[model samples]
Target: MSERTPFRWHIAVFLAPAVVIYTLVMIIPLFATLDLSLYSATETGTKFVGLENFRTLFGDAHWAEQFWNAFWNNVWFFLINMAVQNPVGIALAALLSLPRLRFAALYRSAIFVPTILSFVIVGFVWKLILSPIWGIAPSMLAAIGLRHLFEPWLGQETTALTTVALISVWQFIGIPMMLIYAALLSIPEEVIEAAEVDGITGMAQFWKIKLPLILPSIGIISILTFVGNFNAFDLIYVAQGALAGPDFSTDILGTFMYRTFFGFQLQLGDPNMGATIASVMFFIILIGVCLYLFGIQRRLRRYQF
Candidate 1:
């Protein structure tokens, strides 16, 4: 018999199953959606309409207004998370990772518990806590002599989006905390000791040494937060429903797409329009990721040590 080739095909064979699954599930669906966006359904079944769906999504007065509103609302939601969540997460992580801190593990575990929860559970739990019928939030505010602060925050147009953003921040803070904590832990003890010996202790050491070394990690966390915030959906959908009620004050791209594609209370679904919306969302996410990777990430200098 001829000698067998030395190189084995085992690695490719093992990887083939995963690659096939991903291609079929993700890649195929994405392309199919794109293809469907080019055609509109009618009594005669789907007919090729080229760019008509996109034109209507962007140019028609009624559809365009709702599309823009949802798009802007999504942007606002993302901005709030970036403004509130990352700083708070970084602060908590820094404090918890501090040397000689007591009960650090317990605090970490408690804070991270929310992140492990399902979006539906977290949404309903917060909804109940904030509901006027339950009066839990008002009761707490009254206890602090701030009863005037109480209102149906989630039902009000002014506060609904902010309330939802804060809820998301609360749920996901643990992610950044854990990531940053791990990065902090990776710093060598010898380096920290050297900083202490150089008359740099306490906050000074952290600002000068620790902060510089962890900048790369911070950059990474910021990009991750950016992507996650942009892609957010489930919590808002669960808490506010697909309509994102109170006059659509809480509507984001995801809910908007659902309403447009699947129809709501009285409206009819439009698959082509839905596909257009999905395509827009895909581009938005792609742009944000590219900006982070090429613009922000390239400028960050990761230390070799």
Candidate 2:
């Protein structure tokens, strides 16, 4: 019998490229951003300001208000996805996984089609579709005799965030749908047959038997949704522009950070402040991930079957 090597060259060789790429792309840039947050631009040059920037972000009168607004908006964004997107995905997954369902593959494929499209495309397509003048939304509402409800949703502060959230949900719900579908499919036929024989059919079977087994998957989806929503920017940026306007009603941390970094119409770009915001966002995401790992994932039991 041959003894296993204490160290494997092949493993190291295979891991080297990914490790190098990650260092360059993710780790280095993250540390660089953190480093940038410690310094401030001066009239002549730049100088280290330590935690002064952070204090300004969290305590300064003007900065604090905007920061709080963006933070609360982000929370609202995440909550909306949890409320509508996850449940809808779970329901769609269940429907797709049903036995003897006709055109199941076609349905699944069609449902997932939106998920693979670029956020830019989705943003433009939805923006145009919802436009009041050149678009079909107002006309569609008129056709349904609900033209009173056909006001430009994206142009209104009260409805803009919710409309954007629903659009985001529609675009990405397929991810959770596919994930939950895979999890549902992993259940053994024998276990399902046993449940059926015991008279646990329909909703009872789903709630009692299937739901328990898929708790881990659901937990994963919840955390993933949370993290993704918190970090999301592209669709919002494309749809609403960097200002995320209608009186900044839809502004979240990502857009807030971008506006700070790149300068909007009247505001001058502030890299130090932008970096601080990015660092804060990083911490927020880290806290959420840590909570999922320690608080949520540990409690979610996976069934052997």
In order, how many clashes per candidate?
0, 0
lDDT of all the models against the reference?
0.88, 0.92
Q: Report the error of model 1 at residue 238, Å.
A: 1.3
Model 2 alpha-carbon drift over 4 Å, by segment? 1-11, 302-305
Candidate 1: RMSD over Cα atoms? 2.0
Colliding pairs, model 1:
none
Q: Residues 1-305, candidate 2, lDDT per residue (tens digit)? A: 39865787899899999999999999999999999999999999989999999999999999999999999989999999999999999999999999999999999999889899999999999999999878599888889888888878899999999899999999999999999999999999999999999999999999999988988899999999988988989988999988897888999999999999999889999999999999999999999999999998887854544
Give residue 266's lDDT in candidate 1 (0 to 100). Answer: 88
Local error of candidate 2 at residue 220 (angstroms): 1.1
Between which residue pairs do clashes occur in model 2?
none
Best by lDDT: 2
Tens digit of per-residue lDDT, candidate 1, span 1-305: 49978667898899999999999999999988888888999998999999899898889999899989888888898888888988899889899999899999999999999999999999999999999999999999999999998989899999999999999999999988998899899999999999988889988987899888888888888778777876677998999999897789999988898888999888998888889888888888889889878887777764636
Off by over 4 Å in 1: 1-8
